[model samples]
Target: MAAILSGDRLRFLLGRFKDRLWVKPLVVCLLSIVAAFIAKLVDGTTLAQHVPEIAAESVETLLSIMAGSMLVIATFSVASMVSAYASAASTATPRSFTLVVGDDASQNALSTFVGAFIFSVVALVAVKNNYFEAAGLFILFVLTVCVFGMVIFTFVRWVDRIARLGRMGSTIEKVEKAATAALKRRRNAPTLRGVKLTSEPHGRTVVATSVGYVQHIDIAAIQAWAEENDVRVIVAALPGTFAAPGRALAYISNLSREQGLEQKQEDFDDTRVVRSFHIGPDRLFDDDPRFGLVVLSEIAGRALSPAVNDPGTAIGVIGTLLRLLVLWGEPAVEQDEQAPSYDRVEVPEISVRDMFDDAFTAIARDGAGMVEVAVRLQKALHALALVGDPALRAAAEYHGRLALKRAKAALAMEEDYTAVRDVAMFSETGSQRNY
Candidate 1:
């Protein structure tokens, strides 16, 4: 529970930092102010003699110039990013705008520029006020030079990333990275280290109080609540699940009652469990790989639209999906040294079939007319079939056949039709089956 909470807290903090560019720059400004104070404390006898060449007036002029220029550059950087976000939303789907806006390289570049400006201004003021002795003044000059170097380096890198920030390829990579992380986490703890709730739950059903998608579940809180109530919690709705106001979010089963304790027949408390599950209007990427796949599909769908007519982009998306499926198809390790985090809490594993469908369905539907996309889809499915997981193989086979059928109906050219059907042979358990 501590581990889970700590990890969640760290992830939450990181999400906050990524969303806003000010936090890092704010910290940088504070540190620069502290550095000025620290410079006053350091002795300045020998270093002052050696570094006398750096006149205080020259240092102040340099700092002021850097402060002015960096501020202007930072403003231009923000405007350019806003433009990039708009272009990404217009060219690709708006779903990818969040990733583009929160891009680390661009954010760090802007933060560096802002931080440098703040550092220079504060250091300039300190120098003019004689807050720094000779050594401290020298130290400030050295740090200013270092800051200048960082600005140049960061600006160069930002230039490269800004160009591709909202482009189709970069968007695909961003979504893939996020989905891969989520999938890896799901693979590690498929059931959230709790028993699978297979049959109908026996205890009281805890209905959702609101209508939304389940964004996150506090497993530790649920376990603690279950322990206090002497019950087991069967999670009915995992993250990414849509919950109606009256739908069951979880089920509570009373465990062993104490020997001398009397069992109360009153209502079970559902507040804690309900509060533990966070629901929102849309799905989140942190705990939900399906959302990432959905966005990827949206990108492909836009590419296949008449205005875009970019089958190559769709093919590239299909390739990325194949990589994701391959990572997900790898066998899950069965051994776990530690006990399940929530001994009395149960959670259902995410459905592999659903993930596969979420990933490939729309792309297959939208790209059915293009022979390049159709062949690549079939080949990708056949490759997944080679992973030897029957369920995944079966899902792949189903989508493959469906995509081939769609191609058959949509493609007017016989050569294009033959090209797709030719690659539909799927090998399972040493036996080859043509879709």
Candidate 2:
């Protein structure tokens, strides 16, 4: 019962709810229903008694006009959003399509249109039935004006957002924002609020029963279970990992035969441990930095494709990746001095080396023939090497050499090859002269 209502579980559920396109629109529809009822209530109150009568003809006309126009507007907006999502999928990474579809501005705009339409339709029906009193009519008129104002404001913002919604630059910005958020969360809880897992598990390993990407982990649930069992739970997988039935999801340690069968049976619940983690078909940006990095790399790959041949977009993505890496390299902010949240739960820290590979490996391969991209990549690595730690710098140097080798093989011109090699050598040696 405690694990079921854990904060981690709640947050994971809430995050999933917010990603749906229908959630906001459905909420708006419910709110509209409530508002309609409130308007009727206000009509009977003394506060609305002083208001002048709104003619039946006038109320009918206003409601009819808004109802007709709002439906048309809502349909058009939905079509535009669909088109934008399709374009984003075709041009940028398909993984980014979810973010584009769930954009707050677009969702809010669509919700407003749907809500206004519902309000207008209900108002029209009530007015036609002569159900509204003079005060109710007056209240409805005021709300109509307010809805008009909101619709206009939302339309303006929607137009502006649609213009850049799925473009390369906008997509890069969204990925960077997501990556930064994931990095910050990891920085705070590098081991997922548990002890760091450093080696292979010698204890009983709990394998997954299904195959899917791990989306969210319920650390609170694990902590509670661990405390009850008096054992350390070492997580073998993190968010974005592909869990197979035979693969270890986590490992349990410090078990003994001293406890009776009933106690042992009650303590080790593999199903509960599996339930603590949410598995899904696709990865989410909330808890997975690797997904963001992979999406960014996808954008670079798409830009470097033969049909597109947009090196500039790839360069921009590289710069954004560097910014994300630099942020990840910085130490986490000071945390509270209270007892560690999940002392019995153990998780592994993210690898900077893996991060570097995710950010650059594919881009280097695809953009090898483009001298401009090669030189820029080399220069970027050199800059990163100056600021990054030993492991980070080592990864950067390794990629720098690989990129240079590919550049030499791809570039036919001696000058272009020399230019990229010189940059790569400087990056590798930190020397003034070329190798």
Top candidate (TM-score): 2
lDDT tens readout by residue for model 2, 1-435: 777797767877888888899999999999987776667887667865588877878878877888989989999999998888888889998999888887899999999999999998887888888887878888888888898899999999999998888887787888888889888888888887788777876577888888899999998888888787777788988998998889888888764543532345345776778888888888999899888899999999999999999999999998888888888778889989876778888899888788888899999999999988988888888777877478778888788888888887889999888878777744443364322
Question: Residues 129-165, candidate 1, lDDT per residue (tens digit)?
Answer: 8777778877777788888899999999999989988
For model 2, the superposed segments whose C-alpha errors exceed 4 Å read 255-267, 425-435
Range of the 10 consecutive residues with the lowest summed lDDT in candidate 1: 426-435
Clashes, model 1: 0
| Per-prediction tally of clashes | 0, 0
Which residue pairs overlap in candidate 2's backbone?
Answer: none
TM for candidate 2 is: 0.94
Query: Global lDDT for candidate 2?
Result: 0.84
Model 2, poorest ten-residue lDDT window?
426-435
